[model samples]
Target: MNKDVLTFGVEEEFFVVDRDGHLSPAGDAVVDAADEEEGELQQELTRSQAESATGICTARDEAERQLTALRTDLAEAAARRGCRLLPSGSAPLAETVLPAITPNPRYERMSEHFGATARTSHTCGCHVHIAVPDRETGIRVIDHVRPFLPALLTVTANSAICDGYDTGYASWRYQQWNRWPSAGAPPLFGSLDHYESIVDAWLRAGAILDRAMVYWDVRLSEKQPTVEFRLGDVAATVGDAVLYGVLIRGLVGTILASEARPPKLSNEVLRAQIWRASREGLSGRCPHFRTGDLAPASEVLDDVVTFAAGALAETGDLDFVRDGCARLAAEGGGADRQRARFEKRRAAEDVVDLLAVRPARD
Candidate 1:
């Protein structure tokens, strides 16, 4: 297997809502569709929503092709029933509380464990999975990729806006996740064994249900031969998701290709910075993981993009990175856009209607 070559798969969460905009449990709908291979690409998780996953693809076009089809089927199904499938990292309405069951045993159990930690809104997230050749390679990738997680999050913080409110944070989903124990950044690990050792401690601590439930912003998957990045908020369109997909692959590849110099951090301080980034998004300061210095979030992103040039160039995605950053600057990213829309429309319905505009993938 080529250790240096990396590929990705995308799994996006979508809100399944009824005509009244009430959240619906769609785990059975999604999983059953997967079973028939006929509808929404199946995902195993909590139901008031559904997931559209991709077949492993070597290129962005292929990933988009699969994602588009999957979301279309799911959206059409929901629309047929006078419902809408919306992608958000978390539900925008803090008061819109719903049951968490998804009809899957894994989800049922996982929810029981983390439900206490999750927020009440219905938010969706874009989880990008990168291939890991085997156990050893997987461990190495996890060990080396910690510090860069913030740079990755800042570049893709689409949840800056959700529902009709600004929520005063960039990626509110991270802020939501921080409510649960064992759901934030992990301490830098020196080796796979060391990583697992921490997992073992969590298992023994009874704080986590399994190694798979560790919920790090970036974590090695327990079942898949890959790393799962859970940081990004659900992007509003396929273009946004793909743009992010390209950047994630580049970041991970850059880390894996190097001499394995682990990006170090002091957990307590770093965790505090993580909260600030989650709360402020790009508007406030972010922790510089490497130098442990304070800098504007934009400054932090500028440097990370520079460090990521080689990988982005090799993947033919450097332009996407540069352009995505420029677009964020011009548009103020998701949070800014969300706030502007709310200010203009003065209504959540209009805000969502605007977000529902499906951008053509051309």
Candidate 2:
């Protein structure tokens, strides 16, 4: 595989809030402001949310720079409209009205099909897109990387609160998202043809209306020539997002280099692993994909990092990833930070405030 295959991009969704720190349906205003400034922003399923995507980047530092610029520009644009931007996984405060759907035909069809799930779903997430040599490599990447995705979610956990109360789970957004018809881990496919056949079967069976509804944690991008990872929450800072991008590219590179095939785990076990990761985050044990043995989440994460060390080093991202992981473990992840703020102030709004800013580094 060409080393350039490691090129990647990130997309992050954000919540739009009013001055009172409550979810607000101001996505249009913010998007218009962003458009005037030539920012790469778009409306989401709900009018209360917006998303931004970074251009293709080859280095971790370049990815971080693009993400930081997007976050800063979007926040400033939202502020100009008297609405605040919160890069939180879920809305912090309760909302009385359903957010309006984005004015597009496909989103309209999605709303009609999913009903309340579309209107009430205000969760945000960060998706990583990594380049591959071809369709075969993309299929191979998604298959081989499936087992490790749960542990990746443990690191990006961020939604600890919802509707002014603690949800008790580290990433409530994952739980909410799992409610979709085809939203969990995908089954292993032997070839790119097999993958497309399964997708075709789903569409014909009405399990999904279109290709876009195939919401597996990882999938071949229908719109691009890359494998898309849709597992993690929107990171709380640019650094965290960059860390995720680096680690994903490293994992992909490692898998491609080894020329390994995916192991067959029952769908039941895969779903169980995903749920456990979301529920406990990094505070509990994670089930090892190969051994089926449980270990502390931190230890499991360390093993993952160690497994990809060579790839990370080759990309010149080893030191940054090592330091970033250490910092996350020490200072706590987004969910920990949100819970700490709520615990200290006894107010969910303060958590929203903290989510709005780039968290102070330890």
Candidate 3:
């Protein structure tokens, strides 16, 4: 395989809601009902959620097709069970009762150990996996990709509403997710050994249960030769998910081919940038990683696209990415679109209704 052209996949999480837009514990039923030839649908941390993952794909169209099929399958299955699949970062309305944890031994252990963090957590996210040759290259890509994560989060923020009220943040899921001790932005590592050393310390200190529990925004995949970006909320549409996946692949390809050193950013500033991205999405200013100066979010996004131009062009995804960015700019990020729907009807359920419909193929 060419190092500059990589295979990629996307995983998206969705909430199962009843026709009334209330959280439903139909995750297992939905997974069983959905067709899985295109992609896999599985039970998530909460019984109210289901997660879908595409198979390895070499191009943007391939990934998009799989994601669209998976979403359609999940939606149809949910409808059959009198529930709807809501693709959003956070639940727009509060559940009358706490969501039940999925009945799995690992999940049960997580709930027992993490307590409320595990129990009250029902947020959804989009994770992109890009293949690398080995662990060292994955680590290098993870380090280089660190500076762009906040911008990626901004573009993909979809969790504006939560618990029956406007959370005043684009991706409320980002906030909810960071409550995990091991979650959030990872440190820049000097080498693969350095990365493993930190993981060793965290495991020994009981910060994480195992290698799979390394919940950083970006990390090396434990089960694959890929770097997984756990940065953004589950996108609102199939187009949005494809846009994210292509951008990530482009960024990784660019990073792999370039000999440029990663930037040295302070942990404090990086966290603040992430907080801003989650809070504002594309509606407000984003801190430029190079200068630590705030700029319009759109400008920050442009910077990322410009940086990945060569790779995107090589993969024939440049046009797709450009068009997607334009749409996001005009219509706003997922969170912005959700709030628009809510403002029209002043009902949280309206947001659910808006998200439940799958977008038609272009």
In terms of lDDT, which candidate is strongest? Answer: 3
Regions of candidate 1 where Cα sits further than 4 Å from its true position: 1-4, 30-40, 43-45, 94-97, 111-115, 118-122, 161-164, 357-362
Note the Cα lDDT for every prediction shown: 0.69, 0.83, 0.89
Query: Model 1 over residues 101-140: C-alpha lDDT tens digits?
Result: 6656766676666665432534577889899788677666
- Which candidate, 1 or 3, has the higher TM-score? 3
Q: Please provide, for model 2 over 158-197, each residue's C-alpha lDDT reduced to its tens digit, 9 standing for 90 to 100.
A: 9988888999888899988877887878888769899899
Question: Which pairs of residues collide in candidate 2?
Answer: none
For candidate 3, write residues 126-150 as lDDT tens digits. 9999999999998889888888888
Decoy 1 TM-score against native = 0.87
Over the full model, what C-alpha lDDT does candidate 2 score relative to the true structure? Answer: 0.83
Winner on lDDT between 1 and 2 is 2
Write down the TM-score of every candidate. Answer: 0.87, 0.95, 0.97
lDDT of model 3 at position 284: 83
lDDT at position 148, candidate 2: 92
Clashes (backbone N, CA, C under 3 Å), per candidate, total 10, 0, 0
